[model samples]
Each structure stands twice: as structure tokens, then as C-alpha cells.
Target: MSLRIRNLQSFLRPINRRFPQAVWSSRVVTSIRYNSSTPNNNSSRRPNSGEEGSNKKDTKDSDLPATNDEHNELLEKYNPDKSSRVGTPKGAIPAIDHDLASLLKKPKYEYNPENNTNEVTYEFPPPKSPKQLKVEKIREKSKPKSRFKKIAPSLIAAGLASWGIFTYSYLTSKTDPDKDGETGLLRPDKFLPYVISFKHQIDDDHYLIELTRKNRHKKLINNETLFNGKTMWSIEIKQPDINIVRNYTPLPLYVAGTDPVTKEPHLRLVSESEEQGKFIIIVKKYKQGEFSRWITGLNLLHPVEVRGPIVEHKFPGHPLDKFYIKRPQLANLLSKIKPDPEYPEKLPKPENYVYYGAGTGILPLLQLIYSPNPPKGFIEAYLSIHSESNLLDQFKTLNYFAEKIGRVKFHYFIGEKGEHLSSKDILKPTLPNFTGLSDIKLSEEQYREKLLAEKREEVKRQIANGGISNEGKKSITHEEEENHTIPKLDVSKFKPDNAFQQFNIFKKRKTTPDPSFAFVCGPEGYMADVSGKSDLNNLEMVDNGPIGGKLKEKGWTLQNIKRLQ
Candidate 1:
């Protein structure tokens, strides 16, 4: 009560007039308090209106004495350990040592204005924590790189491009005295030079042209071994003007003599000494063939680009091929067979190996049969033609030999002669079921994919568990097969062109899957008639697609038929 009276006296003294002490002290009763200097304590009571302005009657709180009780309470509230109030100073906050420069607050230093000198005394940039220092370094790195560093990649790329262009020009244009403008031997990877030697225009559509080495001094590497084989191969002659290429099968024939009757060239093949790198190719120029048009128009005695004795197909070589049967040996075999000009007693039991060729497609077939040691067993050749051709001379020569030898027979189906190649007697007897090799291979591939799936999961598990130390980069070497769905075949890519006709010859019979020995080559129409048409893979190489066509209808698979490109 005395403290409340004292406090009210101190408060009311600041404002002039005294408020009733009862109103000042008791908040609930809406009153205050006061202590007077005189022992007349009734001085705290409200005065009547006439005595209101009397200054002497008022008491000041300064006159009131201080109590030990109030002073003791002040000391306790400030001392955190002994403080009556809650949460005045919670758990102790860390403080900086006085000796070190702290970043928390600014230091005080000033200059005397009269003196033209600074009185400040402190080092700049307070020391940072380890984490702050690391963060600062990262920020510096994240900033954009200097001019040189920013453009370094582009500069490097330009330099490399310039170097490549210069290198290619220098290497290609640089001439060697012995090389004859070529760096090395003929190859598929590079287009090498060859000079056009001789060309014979058999007709407006047919051309028999010859290509020989540009560098005659630099002999080719065993060209005989490269060209002669059971495999029917061709070379790609590139038309540089249009940047196009066409594959042509070369014949082993040459001008033997000029015909005394008409002064035309007489053709003859074979001479052991003439086997180096000399051969001629027969080209038929179709109307829309840019490659053919450009090739035939090429200047004589000038160099043209050519590549490869590209192996188109490799047939299984006969066991006797190792013996090297010479022309004399072939002659002896021909002399042994009794000559029968006509089809005698069931046509020599029909040759096990059969060939169906149309137009110039017969060139490769001729190359195979005319080779020193031909395929074992009789070969039945069925040649199909749409018109009468000058090929008759060569045909007569081949058929004459075929009749003398009797091991091979030539069957011609000339459209002009009222004989069609699609004769049932020709195709129905053959066309075997292709042993389902394609299906079997697909099954094996699917099984391999299942194994690969398991392997991929194992690899993922290892990666999650941090097996780098255990594997030592084994995953990089592991073949990662694509998890792609089996793509549908693009039938349009292999579909016959608008120019070519498609023939359909179908026969069905119960067949045991047999190894296919039949090789068919012709225009789209004829091919459609024989085994189905073949397609090219993504690489543009001939792909024996899932065998479907006449052959497929007759239960033939890829294994049973080989289509020549």
C-alpha cells in the first residue's frame, strides 16, 4: 500500500493538479493514492473545489522514503539466475571474444574534425567460417567464364575443320610419279581410277565396254583370285557427273577375230595366259537410267572412277575346286559325253542345281558355268527374254558347248518366239520349301533378348549398391541390346517399280524343308513369278527379307531361295 501511494505521488507530481489519492491507488475502485510530508495523512483525500489550487497541500514522491524491499526486487529481476520474470534471458547465447574482430557489429572510431587525418584503426573484412569460405569459392566459379574460355570450343571446332579440309585437298591432289593419280589399289572404301580401253556398241540399247588399270605399271594384286569364284560378283562403276553408281557383272570374253564376212567383232572366252585383270562388262541403258546414260556418254581414253570386284554372293565351293581343273580337263569331260542334239530320254534327269535368269542377268550365270571348275552336278539354265536380242550368238556358243558336255542344258523361253518363261512345266517341278531358317533365327534372337533383360536388371542393381570397386567398369564392355519392339517390314521399299511387271506362279504340295539351291534373277515381274522379291536392309545392302511371294506360298523360306541383286 505504501509503494502504491508513493508511485501515485510520483506520477501525479509530473502533471500539475493532484488527482484524488483514492482514484490513483485503487484501479478496481477507480481511485489513486498519495503520502504526505505531514503526519496529517488525511491529506491524500480529495479537497473541496475551493481548495483545489493550493500548491503547499500537494506531496511529492521524492519526499517519500525508498524501501529495502523494492530495491531488492530490482536486483533480482536483472540477475537472470535469480530473475522472477520468465524468459527475460533464455539459454546463454554465444558471444565473440573481445580480442578478435567480430562481424556481428560495427566498431566505433572517429576523427577530430580539425585534424586532416583519419583516426579509424581496424583491418577490413572480418574472418569468415569454413562453410562461408567454400560457398564464396563456388559462387566465383559459377560466374561466366572469361572471353577466351567462353569461345574455346568454337575456336577448336573451326581449327579442326580447317585442318580436315586442307588435309583432304592436299592428300587427294598431291601427285606421285609412280602412282598415276591413285594412292593405292582399287577398293570399295575409295573410288580409284580406270581408263576406258574398248567399247563395242552391239545395238542402240546394248554396250560392251572394257575398263583397265590407269596405272598399268602398278600391277593389280592377284585379280584372277579376286574375280573368279563360285560367288557371282560385280563391280560398281560410278558416274561422277551425277554421283551415281551401278553394279555390272563382267564377262571373260574378248575380240578373238574380226568377222571376214561383215567386219564385226567375234567374241571368244578363255586363255590361261590371258587371266590377269582383263574382262569386259555388258551394259543395257534403260531410258530413266541416269547412271547408264552418263556412263555410255563418257569420253574414251579418259579416266573414270570405279570400285570393287565387290563379292555380291558367295556360293558354297565344291570339294573338287581345290584341284584347279584347267580348260583341257573341261574339254576332256565334254568329249566323254555322247552328243544328243535333241531332248533325249527325260532330259538327263533334270540337273540338281537350277537357275532362272532374264535379260542380261544371264551374264553372272555364264561367268559361273564357264569358270574352270563349275558347280558339281548338272545345272539346268532357263533363260527368259522379252524380245529378240543379239545375245543369240553367245547363246548359240553356250548351248553348243552345253550339248557337247551334256552336264549343263540351256532352256530358252523367248516371248517373241511364242514361248513364255512362266510355263508351268518349268517352275512347278522345282520351288522347294526353305527349311524355315528365318523363323528359327528369330526364335533364337527373342531368347537372347530375354537373357539380356535379366542382365540389364542385374547391372541396375549393382549400380544402385555402388559396385564400382567390384565390377571395375564391366558395364561399359557389356553389349546393351536395344529393348525395341520388333519392327514391321517396310514392304514399300522392296515393291516392284512402276516399270516392271510382276508374275505370279504358285503351286502347293507337301514338302520337307530342304536346303535351297535355286538362284533366281530377273526384272520385278519375273522375280515376283519365281521366288518372292528380295529387299534392301537399312544400310542399302540386299537383305533377304522374310521370304514371301510365290516361293512363300509354295512353303519356301529364306533358306530355300537366293535372289541375285
Candidate 2:
């Protein structure tokens, strides 16, 4: 048998040598076929009958060798399985055993449904002992700090350097004469130029101009006591070819008004600054006035020179105090007439102040009236204007003050003939041309009679309107009657002659025992006509005028009258 096998091998060796690669490939194919065809009892059962049978046969054939011992040994020497098989199936991935996979997996705590509760329990770390805390603090201190903490000193030094530079620049620039030279009547060292920060139109010809100081001079303008007392500041403006200067009394920087939503009185918001301060000035443009034209034509950031808290007037204890020495004639007259018992030490502030103003001349008076703490008295202001629309536009601000004080009386005199009937008309006879020439002015008696007649007509009208009971002779209650009555003082169209009549009525009205004063501000002729020689019945007059010659002619001494222009 061995000799026969050797002869067969000798015959095959020549064929193997001639086709070495073919022989190796055939051996690999035979091995695969034998492994696929063999069956084994230990093979796993499959669901598909045909596939299960094939897999069983493949398992059984894998145990049997296809060639003799010599061939088997040679094949084993060149077997691809030794390097590549790795115990895996052909084209099939090796799977981990169930027990081995479980050992390799991360351990997990099984969830218990019974332990799932809505209440949450937190595991807090145990508190450290005092000694441990102290040790930790010491360790933290010894450790290196953050980058920001390390460079904090450098940052502070840089900040201080910047502040010093700014201070030096500010002091030098503000004081430098070449940089801020004197303009007009304003001295650069004292009054400086303020740039126009904002402009708001209050009316057709009225504007509220806000002026701000330059950055370098901000500290100078931030003076708390800059605008104090009843004084005015002068503004210097230069036109292309004209030099014009005007004096203005600035309005209060802040005012008190009722909040629209809350109906509570609050300090109305005002535009102001701290380091860079600003002030507002109200200007009224005039048709032919050069100063007004120049002011109105200014643009935003326009520089304006401003100076002073110019003293307009100073009040003495009495009207005759300043004149007592000047006029010797007053000494004898004053000795005979005992000083007023109510005002023995000093002339008391008027219990009732009747103010008369025309157009923009009313500004200073308005400022005084709306002062934070004005004189304790009632105010009756009569303003004469060219149009009623002008007063209507300012009604909100005026009404706010009126409502705040609750004692303010505002009477507007609109200058239009057809819209208003003159008080003098009441004295005229029914006939167009009377036989006897009568005085156009009405006597005091006639004026009182006319008022009585008007009151009777008003009562008759009320009776017709069911405000009074005809049969019972019973009228409406006082409160109900007041509701129907017109406002005592309100905007009204008036003839030029009506101003004198209104002044007379205001003077006649009864007031507290304290003395009263009448202030009149307007055109030369208007001031004269209102404050002219007339029996005021203990009412003193202060004329605000550009020219006091007319008042002086009327026996009004300089001491008795205060003028602002």
C-alpha cells in the first residue's frame, strides 16, 4: 500500500510543480466543499427545513479531511485559516457569547417602579469642620490668583492716568484766552459761549431754546446757585452785519404738574445735565425787531454768549423809604400820617396782586408767579394780546399753575374790534349822534349800574332755562348755581379800551386787610394808559417799562415804582 501511494505521489508531484497555483486553489475549494457538506449531531437547529438540513450537513462535513495524511500535512502547512480564519464562519461575523457579553457590559441598577416617587431627595455633601474650612481658605490664599486680579494694579494705574490727563486738559483749555476769546460784552474768563443743544417751538413766534456748555467748561456752568432771585440774564448774539443783545428771564428749570394717568402732582421732567449743564430761555420773535429775528434764525449748536444774574429791582420797606431823604417834603407828610398798623415794621407783601402784561412782556411776571414758593397772596393777571389763539395754545401750562395754586385768576384781553364790545359802549346813548357831547368814558356809578343790569338779565335767562322756580320763587342751590356760572377769569376777546375797565373792576374787588399792589408791563402807551393818574383807592402801582418818564410825569417817584426792561 505504501509503495502504491508513493508511486501516485510521484506522478502528482510533477503535475503540482507544473501548475502550483492551480493546485493550491483546488485544495482551498475542496476544503470549503467538504466543510459545507459535512453534518454533525452538535449542529444548532434552524427554522427553515432546507437551510437547516444544509447547515447540519456542512457541520458534519467540516470534521472530515478531504485528502491523505501527506496531502493533509502539506495543506496544513499552507492553510489560509492559520492566519485569516480566526474561528469565524465564511462571510459571517463572529458573535460574542451571551455570558461573556454580560461580563463586558457596564453594570446598571435595575429600576424599581415602587421606588419611583414624586418627592425629590437630594444627596448633599457633609459640612466641613471649622478647622477644615480654615485650612481650605489658607490654601486658596496661597494658590496663584486669576489673571484679572494679577493685572488689577496696572488697570487702576491706567485709569488714574486717564483721569489726570482729562483734568489737565480741562483746566488748560477753559482758561486759555486764545481758545475761548471774549465775544461781545461777555468776558471769556467769566461768561462763556453756550452751544444751542435743542430748540422747541411753543407757539408760532415763541420758542424755548436750550443751551449747553462745552465739555471743558462744564464745571463752571454746573453752579447750583447760578440762577437765584428775581433777576435776568443777558444773551449776546451777532448777526452777519448787526450786533444785537437781549435780556431774558429764564423759566423755572422744573415745574410741578398733575400726572395725566395718576392725577398726582409731580415735578415735571425737565432737560438738564450734571457735568455738562444746560439752561432754557424762551424767545418771542417780532416782525421788525432785529434782536428777535437774530435769535429765531439761530440753528442747532449755534454759540451764544451769556452773562449775569442782572438785578432788575430791589424793594425797600416802604415806597417812601428811598425817597424820605431825597424829598424833604415827604418827612412832614409821613410824620402826620401814622404808619399802617398792619405793616409797622415793613411794607407787607400784597394780599392781592393784580398783574397787567401785554405780549412777551408777561414772561418775567409768569416766572415770579410760578416760583417754587411764591409770595403768599392771590394772583389776578390780566394779559392783553393781539390774538386769543396765542393764549389758547399756552392754556395747558397756565391752567396747570392755576389748578396747582387754586387761587390764580387769568384774564385774557384779545385785541379785535368786532369780536368784543368795549366797556365804554355802555355809556353811549342809543342815538347815533347825540345832541349833547358826552364823555366816552363811563363814570364809576354808571359802570356799577351797568353791572347790575347785566346781573338782572342773567337771572332772567336762568329763570327761563328752569334754573329758578317761578311759582315758589325758589332758585337753584348755591352749588348748582355755581355750576351754571361762567368762569370768573378766562380768555376773552376785548377792545383796547376794555383793559382800563378790567383794571378798575379788579381794584374795586374786596380783599384781605393787607395792602395790594398792581404791576403793569406793556408798550409805552399801554403802560401809561393802564397806570395813568387814576384814583386806585389805596392800591399801589409798579410800572414795568422801557421808559419811566410817562409814570414820573404822573407823580410816580422812582422809589414807588419798579421797572424791568
Candidate 3:
């Protein structure tokens, strides 16, 4: 019902206690008129009580049974506090009639961080600023005396062992009290180091030694410098005692005999008996060879250290199976040939002869050719005579021998034109029968021909192989200037008269000298020639310099011993 209508009805019906019935009715009528005048929809479109319409329906059921007593008891027990409503949930705001279910529910209180509901959300007051941890130093405690006592024996033993080792070393290496600083064979007072000995003379601006390192001894046993101190000879048969020579430089110097057991360095002597023994060492004064100079300074009859006779040259077969060519062959050859009656008889004969010696290359060759101990057959004699002056005497000597034997042949290439025979002159016998280099003569054409002929065959072959020739091909691919040049005959193409053929026709020819048996002692070119020729026999010729040296392009070794040093 409307508020005004309800108020008016209540006023008209109940008025016994307060009097003024007219006044109350008049007030109610007035309020009713005012409410009727106002618009109803504006204030009461819906009832404030949610059960307003539903209450009318429940009134009919209430007449059947009154549950007020049980309901009152529930109210008394659940709602002891009058301010709270127990029948309906207390403090529940009425839900709005809308589509949103969450909005219809009670609004939750926004959380304050200080009063968080989650128990884990509590943060322990930020860790109190941590204190720095400090490292503590430890104090050492003294060990008991018993521990040191136990280890004392071990320490003493160690010290004794170390001392013993030191003492042994000192004793082994200690010098003799009588001859301080002396070890090997000689005493300190007369200690003689291994040195080269030479006799000198002045020629032009150079100082030349007539001989070099004639004597070298292993031990001081029976040492003697014979032939007015020009020759030295010593005997060392005790192999096991002197292992230094062979162990140090195992190979033979000239042949073998460097090794004590091998006895290869020992050579055969002219004497019919085999007891004779000697050693010959040929050393050249190189541009700068310290060993050569040292050898020249040694004194006669004085001790000179002798190393192995490493045999550089070999026989027909195995090279390692060598003997000393110097002591026997070289010595024997020298005794027979050397005009000096003073020459020793103990020396051995030179198996093969070699010249081209700066100073001594000619020594062995001379001895072999002229000596009674000459090789059983023909021998190769090469000489390295640099200057015309040195050649004069040598040439005369060589000529005499060549004519005397008529079996010996020579090959000589001169680097310089003057005072030396050209290759052609030597190859072809000319007027005066020019015995040596001084007799040869040549013209400009001949010189040019000689120069052009060198390596001509190789050049032609290279061209034929589509290397340099302008042949039929349209294109010309020349890698070098030499490729463009034409080939001509040179010394390489020159074939000497076949001495073997002559031997076969005239004298009974033995087997051709095995090229391997060639004895080469000269400049590098001479040695190379021998080596190359010896290739036919598979000879293992010894050469010091590596292939393709500075003169590699010229196809020659600058170290060639055209003339002796």
C-alpha cells in the first residue's frame, strides 16, 4: 500500500489515547492528498521488501499450521545478540537483479601489503647487514725429539750416497799428480796435441807448404820421426785399447784402417814382407781451413793426435770393408819413386794414383807412378796445379812419366786462358808435342766453338722434346734463354781415344778398370767428371759439396779443382 493511504487509515481507526481525532484525521487527509498529487512511479516503482508479492501467497499456507513457536526457538538460540539477524545471513546486502553472478556476490576487501592474508607473503625483515668472515692463522707445534731420531739414519745414508758418487767421479777424472792435466799417452811436460805438420816456402804472394801432416800417432808407443824429421811412423796393434780413433771418425781417411779391428786404413807396402807400416795424410791449405793450418804447425818427433783413416776412396766392391791406403800403398810408392835416398822403406804402396793436389794431391800420385811399388796395372794420375810456375816442374815430371810409361793418360781443363793449355791442345797433339799446358795454342773461333759446345747435346734434346725449338709448331714457349740457343759440340761430346781398345789390340787387355775403383783427387769438376764416368760402373764416388751449388746453372761445380789450390 501507499505510505499516505496507510497513514490515513491508521489515524481514522486508532485515537483513544491521544484525543484530537479531528486533528489526526485532518493531518492524514492532507498527507494523503499530497502523496496522491505526487507521481507514484517516481518513488515506488518496486517495493523495498523483496518478499512483498511473495508474502501474500504464503498467508494462505499460514492458516494450515503456525510454525512460529519452532521458528522463535531457533531465533532465540541462534540470535542471542539482538543486533544480528540469524534467520537470514547477517550484514548481507540485497543482490541486484542483474546478469553478473560475481557482481551479485559480496565485495571482498582490497588487501593492504602490511596486513597480507597469505602466510608465505611475510618477508623476514631484510637480512641484517652480514658481517665479514675472517681467516684464522694456525700456529705450528714442535715435533717430539723421537721423530727426528728415527729419520736421522736415512738422512745420513742419503748424504753418504751423494758423497760417494761425487768421490767416484772425482777419482775417475782426476789428473795424474806427476803430470798435471795430462791424460792419454804423453806426460804433461811433453804433451803434444794432434797437429798438422808442414814445410813452407814463399811463392808469389802466397805461403805454400811442401808437405802436410806426414805423421800422426795414436799412442806414444815406439813413436819415431824418420827421414830427417820429414816422415813420421808409429805402430798401434792394440785394438781394444785405442777405441777413440775408430769410434770417433769411423770411416777410413783415405781408404780404411781407421778402425782398429778392421785395419782398413793400413795400406800395402813395397817391402816384400807385410811387417812394414806407415800413414800418409794429404791436406790442402784451403781459403780458410783451420784444420789444415793446425796440421802445418806441428813439430817433428813430437806427439800428434791421430784420428781415423776414414777411407774416402774405395776398391771395386764394398766401401765399408776398407783398409788404410796411406800407411802401405802410399808409403811404398813414395819410397820407390822419391829420388831422395833418405826415403823410408817402411811406407806402403799406393794402390791407385791421384794428382790435382794443391800441395799434396800430387804426392801420392808421384810416388805411385815413379815408385817400384807402382800399382799392378794402369793408374789414374790427376794433378791440381793452379799457377803456371807450379805447373812448369810438375808438367815436366808428368811428361817424363807419360812418355816413359806411354800407358798413362791425362785430362786437364784450364779455367783461365793465359799460361795454360786449352782443352783442344791437350786432346790433340800439336807441334813441339806440347808436353804440358804451356805448349797449347788456340784462336778465337776455337775458343768460341769450345764454349758453344758445352751442354749442346742436352740443349738439343730439350729442343727435340718440344721444349725450345721453333720447329713446325706455330707457338714458341721458351722458358729460358738457353732454351732458345742451338746446340753445338763441347768437351762433354769429345770422346778420347779408347785406351781399352788399344790395350786389347796391342797388349793383353784385362777387365776395364771398374769405374768404382777410380781414385779422384782434384778440383770439384774433376771429381764430378770421375763420378759421372764412374756411374757406368755404379761407382760410389765421394764428393763433399751438395749438388747444384752456385755454379749449378753452368752445370759445373765452382769448387772444381782445375788447378791445385
lDDT order of candidates, best first?
Answer: 1, 2, 3
lDDT of 1 by residue, 453-514 (tens): 98999989888755666547533332333553588876535533211111111111133222
For candidate 1, the 10 contiguous residues with the lowest summed lDDT are 499-508
> By TM-score, how accurate is candidate 2?
0.42
Judging by lDDT against the true structure, name the best candidate: 1
lDDT (10s digit) by residue, model 3, range 1-565: 3455446445443332233322334333433443454355643655448766674455344422125653452333333445532232223223423643444355668866667656564556444333421211112224345877889999999999999987876786565452223333222223223322233322432333221222223232344222111111121111223332211111011222333773222233223222212333333445574544444444554335443222332222211112322211223222233211111212222122223332334443443443332333344344446554443343345445442333345544333433332222211111221123332233334556766786797678667766753564434456754478776645434333332222333344353231112233444555444332222233554344443322233233323312221
- Supply the TM-score for candidate 3: 0.28
Off by over 4 Å in 3: 1-198, 202-283, 286-288, 297-302, 317-374, 380-382, 388-403, 410-519, 524-565
> Whose TM-score is higher: candidate 1's or candidate 3's?
1
Candidate 2 Cα lDDT to native: 0.49
Error of 1 at 429 (Å): 7.8
Minimal lDDT window, size 10, model 3: 246-255
Comparing 1 and 2 on lDDT, the stronger one: 1
Q: Write the per-residue lDDT of candidate 2 for residues 101-214, one digit (tens) a residue.
A: 554465657876447786365366457899999999999999999999999999999999999988887789777864653322233235566677667666688776766655
Q: lDDT per model, in order?
A: 0.57, 0.49, 0.35
